[model samples]
Target: MIDLKALQNNFEAVSQKLKKKKIDAALLELLKEESLQLKEKRNLLEQLQADQNAKSKLFPIYKKEGKDIAELKSQLDQNKEKITAQQEVVRLLEEKLSEIALGVPNIPDDSVPEGSDEEDNIELKKVLDTPVFDFAPKEHWDLDSNQEWIDFERGVKLTKSRFSVLKNDAARLERALVNFMLDFNRSRGFDEVSVPFIANQDSLKGTGQLPKFEDDLFKIEGENLYLIPTAEVPVTNLFRDEILTADELPIKLTSYTACFRKEAGSAGRDTRGMIRQHQFGKVELVALAKPEESDQVFDDMLSCASDLLTALGLPHRLVMLCGGDLGFGAAKTVDIEVWLPGQNRYREISSVSNTRDFQARRAMIRYKDGKKNRLVHTLNGSSLAIGRTLIAVMENYQKRDGTIAIPEVLKKYMQ
Candidate 1:
């Protein structure tokens, strides 16, 4: 949620920033009107209640003086009825305000590079080196089939498309990779966690995955629960509706979860291979920070993710996501694309995003600052999508005999 008070006070500045997201001025203005009306009504109700209390206080004096009490009793009954009606109205108004608040996105940073879509994404720098293969290289699907690792046909028989079975070294390598990534991040001061795979609607909304993006979520029928689309959702929302001391400002968390997605709108793309899947494993990094610390924290997360890929000897590059291509809840995002030797191109293996206070506002996560309370800034990122990284490793580390060499960094974990 946006700071309604700040939006009201800095309407123009906020509006201009939101314009990058293409939110209309009319809607924002309507929110302001609703907020003002609610505040006014509630304030008036308070005044009336105070006045009624004062009138009632006179009743004891009148009764003690033996004065007529019939008229005063009738007036008191009428005041109570009015107060009850006002209380109901306040409830409705508060719900209305809540609906508006939760859907509002964070204001874009002044320094965010503005443009439309991924094409406008600014490339940062390339890391390590792209591998050059001498043989007729095969993509992950071909390699996996050749190695008898991924059995997509049987996976479909069991759970349908967008699912697969990893056998032999592939399955072992995947497990090793997951453990290696978790240990790698935990050593960097990120507290590791194992979170629930399914969350309620409110939790999804808090992470900006509901309302607008419902089509993308795998919802439990006849229930408010939905499977998490990423570890980021569950990890970042851990502090939902919480208030922490300022000393706990830069809270860092990492988690591994199986992500589920309906992918309703993403049909006919990346249908093959693990580039996109209904269920995929991921290691996520989530942080809570003050405004000034958010960007640096974002950089640190990117470095942590980049280091993992670098240590695996995978060539990669980073790019800044443009306005149109930025995630719905992120102020800015950077994607790390790792080189796949067989594909001869860099594919996104991870993404680090800084949402600032966008998520905190929606979740009501705050920190007390002396006598005042302020919303904390929240950030989350896929340190690495396990499926994609596995794909990259298979394609890049394939020996002439179709055997895959596990990355040196992951060998210890395999034991």
Candidate 2:
């Protein structure tokens, strides 16, 4: 959610920022109208409450002074009704306002580069050089199709499209990647956690996944439970509705999970391989830090993701997502796209984002500093999408005869 106070103070400036993200101007207009109504109704309710309190005190004095109490009682009754009605009005206003607020994307940081689309996103530069292939590369499916390593046809038959079965080394490789990432992050002082794959509605709402974007979730039937779209949901929600000690300023956590996505809004893109699967394997990193520490955490997460690609001997690039290309929950985001020789271009394998306090305020995840508690900033990213990394490796490391040469970093884990 946007900082409504800031938006209220600098409405015009924020309006211009929204355009850089290509968001509809109607959102700000809605916010402006709702904010006015909220302020008015809230003020009226508070005044009524104060009046009722004052009346309770004066009523007894009127009776004790031998004064006729009928008018005072009648006045009290009328005020009671007025307070009740105003309270209800305020309640309705809050509901409407919060719904609108939930749909608004996070405000981009000032230093964020401005652009309208992917083509406009700034390239931070390549990480490692592309491998010099001895022969033309083969797509992952072509290399693993009949080898019992990855079964696509069976995946489509069992579960719908965009799902696959990893067998043999492919299956173990996924596990290896998860362990590798967890250990790597642990070395950097992040705690490892196993989060529930299924989260309750409150968890989803806490992370700003409900009310809007519900269509992109796999919700459980006859219940408010939702299959998590990413470990980001559960991991980031670990501190939801709580206030931590200030000493615990930066809460770092890493988790491995199978992510589910409806991909309801993504149509006709990356349909060929595991690049855009409905279900995929991923290692996630999450951090809850103070507002001042957010940018550093974002940079660190991006660096960790880049290191994973370099360690795997894969070619990839770092892209600073333009305002329009940023995620709904992110103030700033960096996408790491690995070079896929078979596809002859780079495809995104991970996105690191600093949501600042947007998700924290929604989740009520805060830290106590002295006597005051304030919302903690949140950050999350896929260390690397394991399934996509496998695709990149298969395509980049394929022999002319269609066999994959495992990367040296994974050789110890392979056998």
Candidate 3:
């Protein structure tokens, strides 16, 4: 959640920044009104309590003077009733403020481009060159069908639409991609971790995936748990509600997990092949750093993701997300889009983001330095989305005879 004081002190500036992300200004208006109401209610409650205390003191004096204390006691009793009602009002207003705060998106960083959507995103650079096809290239679905590697029809029958079952090389390819990504990140000072695919409500909320984006989640009935949409949720929550020493300022972790998403608003997008799925494997990189070092950490994370693509010899490019395209919790984001020969365009395979204490504030994650403790900055990104990587490899490595060759870097993992 955003700092209330910051919002109040720089209301116009905050509102303008949020407007770049397409957030409604009315939400801020409501928050301002609720904040004022809470203050008023709290002051009223304090006054009532003070009045009761003052009356109690007078009661003793009246009793000693043999005067009737009945009137004072009656007034004190009424004050108590008023205080009780006022307290309840204060509690309700506080709840309203909290709800609004949680719903508010993080303020985009100053450097973030001011655009309205994905189309306005700026491309940073392209690495490697798109593969030259000897013949008319086939889409991933067509290639999978010709090679019998992915069983899309049976996946739908077994589960539902947007779900697929990998067969033979395709299954091994996904596993190989996960191992390669985890190993690659682990070799780069990232501790390999295995987190639960299911996370509790607090964990999701800590990562800023709850309350607002609940529709995109798979909630367990009669319980507060939900299937994790990314390893970011559980892995980033590891330090939630805790304060770390300054020495542990940057905590880096990598995990491979099977993610689940409802694709809530994406009705007909990427409906073919493995581009979009109900369940897919991904290797994620999550880090915690001091606020001042978050930008550097973000750049490093981006390099780590780019390195994975470079290692696989896959052509890709980095694109800076515009304000409107930024994630709910991210202050700034850069996406790695790998080239897909079959699709003949780049597709997002990973997105690295630095939330700049946004998640830390929500998770209550802090670091103690000397006499003070402050929120730590949190960052997360997919080293590579396993299924998308698989698609890239299959399309980029396909032979004229309809056979797919594995990338040289992943050969050992496949073995």
lDDT of each: 0.85, 0.87, 0.91
Give one digit per residue, the lDDT tens place, for model 1 in 195-312: 9999998788888887878889888999889999998777878888888898987999999899998788878988887788888889899999988888889988999999999988
Model 3: per-residue lDDT, tens digit, 1-415?
A: 8877778878899888888889888989888778877888899889989888888889779989999978888888888899899999999999989999999989999989999899999999999999888797888888767548888888899999998888888888888888888889989889999989999999999999988999999999999899999999999999999999999879999999999999999999998888999899999999999998988889989999999999999999999999989999999999999999998999999999999889999999999978899999999999999989999998888889888888999899888
Residue 305 lDDT in model 1? 97
- lDDT of each residue in 1-415, candidate 2, tens digit only: 7888878889899888777777778878888888988998899899988988998898789888989888888998999999889889999889988888888888888867888789989999898888777777777767766757888888999998998888888888888777777888888777899989999988998888887889999989999899999999999888998999989878888899989999988899878867888898889999999988888888888888898889888899999999878888888888999999888899999999999999998999999888999889999988989899888888888888877788887877777
Q: Which pairs of residues clash in candidate 3, taking residues 3 or more apart in a chain or in different chains?
A: none
Candidate 2 has its poorest 10 consecutive residues by lDDT at: 138-147
TM per candidate comes to 0.93, 0.95, 0.93
**In model 1, what lDDT does residue 407 have?**
87
Provide backbone clash counts, one per model. 1, 0, 0
| lDDT top scorer | 3
Off by over 4 Å in 1: 56-67, 84-92
- The runs of at least 3 residues in candidate 2 whose Cα sits more than 4 Å from the true structure, single-residue gaps closed, are 57-70
* Candidate order (TM-score): 2, 3, 1
RMSD, model 2, all Cα superposed?
1.9
